[model samples]
Target chain A: DVKVTQSSRYLVKRTGEKVFLECVQDMDHENMFWYRQDPGLGLRLIYFSYDVKMKEKGDIPEGYSVSREKKERFSLILESASTNQTSMYLCASSLKGYEQYFGPGTRLTVT
Target chain B: DQQVKQNSPSLSVQEGRISILNCDYTNSMFDYFLWYKKYPAEGPTFLISISSIKDKNEDGRFTVFLNKSAKHLSLHIVPSQPGDSAVYFCAASDRSGGGADGLTFGKGTHLIIQP
Candidate 1:
């Protein structure tokens, strides 16, 4: 079975702070994705990486960036956290043409 | 532009009954459809998927039916148990949509099973 793990299950940060959310997948899949879920908006893709050091913007990718230093790890970074950034963040990985496996998700509260 | 849409935000059904969740997509180019189930505090899990080549796909008690002309799909859960209660999301991807493109998701439908 594939396992996707996130660094923090819950986090709280004050406004203007920088935050980093980490995700690791055991399967070594080539594709990794970051998404944010908000009420009435479902899961909106923030960023996705198809290879190490390569990233692409999704539908919503403002105030957020990503890094893939290693194939198994993907990180999401918020340059300056704001109250509106509070939401549930999800990480997913998949091989091409396959369904994605998701991590437990990280709930970040920017106060 | 919210290409994918799940009109019903919430649905309530009695346990052991059939729960039908509907989804609609505005883009006809989408060829692959997928359903994901999300529990409280957990990320969405892939439930079942159907390609454009087929109209119906079944797995255990869950089945997905796709209508090409209408640009719609439905997930039917028979004899739904309490564990089946969760949020269901409808997603779609076109043939050209590469892995990096990811899947477009709907707003999601919350299913509640009452015993």
Candidate 2:
């Protein structure tokens, strides 16, 4: 079975602190994505990478950036965490014309 | 604007009964529609999908129906089991650009299976 792993399952950080969320996929998928999910608002895309060293801004890219240094790993970075940035973050990977496989989400809370 | 919308936030059905979850979209350009089931504290799992060219797709007990003219779709589960209690999300995409872009998702509906 394909596996997608996230570095952290739960995290708490102080306001203004820098945060890193890591995602790794073993399927050699060509597409990786980061999304933040909130109650009533659903999942909103933050960023995505289609290839190594390439990234694109999604609908809600503010305060977040991504790095895809390798084909198997993608990282989401929060330059400066804020209270409003706390949410459940999800990582997903997919190949062309295939369904995306997701990692167990990381729930982040900024105090 | 929410391109995909799941108007019902929650639904309850008895075991061995039918459960129907509805979803609507505003974008006519969306040609692919999918449903995902998520358990608490877990990531959403792919359920079933239907393309705009076809109106219905079925996998075992799960059936997905699409109405292109109205931009509406639904997931029907027959003889719903207790394990089926989870949140369901509806997603849509155009996929015309080739590469896996992003999928617009609905808010999701929480389904409760009663015994």
Candidate 3:
């Protein structure tokens, strides 16, 4: 089965602090994505990577960035955590023209 | 503007009843559509998908129908069970980048199945 793992399930950070959320997929899929889920807003894409060292901005990439140094690993970085940035983060991996598999997700709170 | 829209915020259905969730998209570029189910704290999981070339696709108890002309799609769950209670999100993709562009998602509908 396809397994996607995130570094943390829950995290708390202070405002202005930098935070990193990591995700790794065992299936070796070519595409990795990061999304944030908010109440009433559903899930909004933050960033995505199609290959190692390649990245693309999604609909809501303003306060976030992503890094994919290895094919199986993708990381999402928050330059400076803000109250608005506190939300559930999800990671997904998918092959070309296939459905994506998702990680358990990380709920981050910025105080 | 919201490219995808799930007008209903929630729906309640009794066990063994058919539950239908509807979605609409305004973007003509969306050629592929998908449905995802999400629980409380877990991430959303892929449920079903339909390409623009097909009008309907089914898997077990779940079926998805797509109408290109109306830019609408719906997911139907037959004999809804307790496990079917969750948030359902409708997503669409243009496939212009071969899935690398990601997908646009709707606000989601919370489904509740009563026994």
Candidate 4:
């Protein structure tokens, strides 16, 4: 089966600490996305990479960044974890912007 | 502003009944719509999708209906099972904006199935 996997299912971080959430897809899709899923706000895209080393800011890219060193892997980085940044982080991959396959998600708790 | 809207935050239905979840969109440029089901602590999974060219699409017990004129679409689940209970998010995409696109999602409707 096609699969998207994340490095962590849950993470706890202290304020001001740098954080990295990793995702990988075996499908060799060119498009990879990072989104923060929050109550009442739904899934807001933080950043996406259509190709390796190419990234674009999404609707809510503030305080976040992403890296796509390889086509099969995309990473979301929080420069500094804050209490308000605590939320579910999702990673997804798609071929040519079509139906996306998502990872299980990493729930981050920044305290 | 939310381009895709799921006004209902929650819905409850009994087992063996039909569960209707509604969504509306404001962007006329949107040509593709999709429904995703998410359980707690898990990522949302693609459920069904409908393109602007079609009005209805069905897969097994789930169906998606699109009304382009009204800018509305809905997902129907027949004989709602407990396993079917989850958060449903409506999303849309417009390729006109350029680049490989990302989806605009609604707040999500939490569906509850009771026996």
Candidate 5:
């Protein structure tokens, strides 16, 4: 079985603070994705990396960025956290043509 | 524009009955479809998938049906259990390759099993 682990299961931060969410996968999949899930809107892609040091902006990537310094690790960074940024964030990894395995998710609250 | 759409926001069914969740997509290029189940405070988990070439794919009590002409697909859960209550998301993918492009997801449908 594939396992994806997120650094934090829950987090709280004040407005204007910078936040980092980490995710690691044991499968060594080539594709890693970051998504923010909100009520009524569902899962919206934030960013994705196909390989180390390569990233692409998803549908919603305004205040978020990503880093893939290693094959098994991917990080999501918020330059300036805002109250509206509070939501459930999910990390997923997949090999080409295969189903994606997701982490437990990080629920971030910005106050 | 929303490429994939789940018209129904929620559905309720009694235990031991069949629960049907529907999904539609505007992108004709989508050749693969998937269903994911998500519980509160948890990430979505892959359930079942169907390729465009096949009309139906079944696994255990869960089944997925696809209609290429209508660009629609559905998931049917037989003998719905209370534990099956969760948010179901439908996703579509145009191609499957080792790249950053992931599947496009719908708004999701919350299935409530009435026991």
Candidate 6:
């Protein structure tokens, strides 16, 4: 079974603070994605990487960026965290044209 | 604009009954559909999937039915148990994009099973 692990299960940060969320997948899948889930609105893609050092902006990528220094690891960075950024963040990995396996989400609280 | 929609925000059914969750997509380009179940504080888990080429796909007590003409799909869970209670999200992908593009998801429907 594919295992995707996140660095933190819960986090709290003050406004304007920079935050980094880490994710690692054991399956060595080529595709990695970051998404945020909010009430009323479902999970919205934030960023995705198809290869190491390659990233694409998803529907909601503002204030967020990503890095893929290694094939098994992907990171999400928030340049300046705001109160509105508080939400559940999910990391997922998938092979080309296959179903994605998601990691235990990180619930972030930006106060 | 929302490409995918789940009209029902929540559904309540007695345990051991059938739970039906519906989904609709506005994009005709979407050819692959999937259903995911999410428990509180946990990431959504892949449940079942159906391709445009088929109308139905079954796994265990969960089955997905797709209607290409209507651009809609439904997931049916028979003999639903308490463990079946969770948020169900319907997602679609344009396979022609070669899977690099992430899936478009609906708002999700919360299913509650009452014993």
Clashing pairs in 4: none
Q: List candidate 2 stretches off by more than 4 Å.
A: none
Of the two candidates 2 and 3, the one with more favorable DockQ, higher being better, is 3
TM-score (0 to 1) for chain A, all models?
A: 0.99, 0.98, 0.99, 0.97, 0.98, 0.99
Model 2 TM-score relative to the real fold: 0.98
Error of 3 at A70 (Å): 0.2
Q: How would you encode candidate 4's per-residue C-alpha lDDT over B46-86 as one tens digit per residue? A: 99999899999999999999999999999999979999989
TM-score of each: 0.97, 0.98, 0.98, 0.98, 0.97, 0.98
Pairs of colliding residues, candidate 1: none
| CAPRI quality band, candidate 3 | medium
Q: Write the per-residue lDDT of candidate 6 for residues B14-102, one digit (tens) a residue.
A: 99999999999999999889999999999999999999999999999999999999989999999899999999999998878653759
Please list the residue runs of candidate 5 whose C-alpha ends up more than 4 Å from where it truly belongs after superposition.
Answer: B96-98
| Two-way DockQ contest, 1 vs 3, winner | 3
What is the iRMSD of the candidate numbered 2? 1.0
Best by DockQ: 4
- Cα miss at B111, model 3 (Å)? 0.4
Tell me the tens digit of each residue's lDDT in model 3 across B1-115: 9999999999999999999999999999888899999999998989999999999999999999998999899999997999999999999988874648598899999999999
Query: Per-residue CA lDDT of candidate 3, range A40-73, in tens?
Result: 9989999998899999999899988888989999
Give a tens-digit lDDT track for model 1, residues A7-108: 999999999999999999999799999999999999999999999999999988999999999999999999999999999999999887668889999999
lDDT of 6 at A60: 96
lDDT of 6 by residue, A1-111 (tens): 999999999999999999999999999799999999999899999999889999999999999999999999999999999999999999999987778889999999998
Reference-based lDDT, each prediction: 0.94, 0.93, 0.94, 0.93, 0.93, 0.94
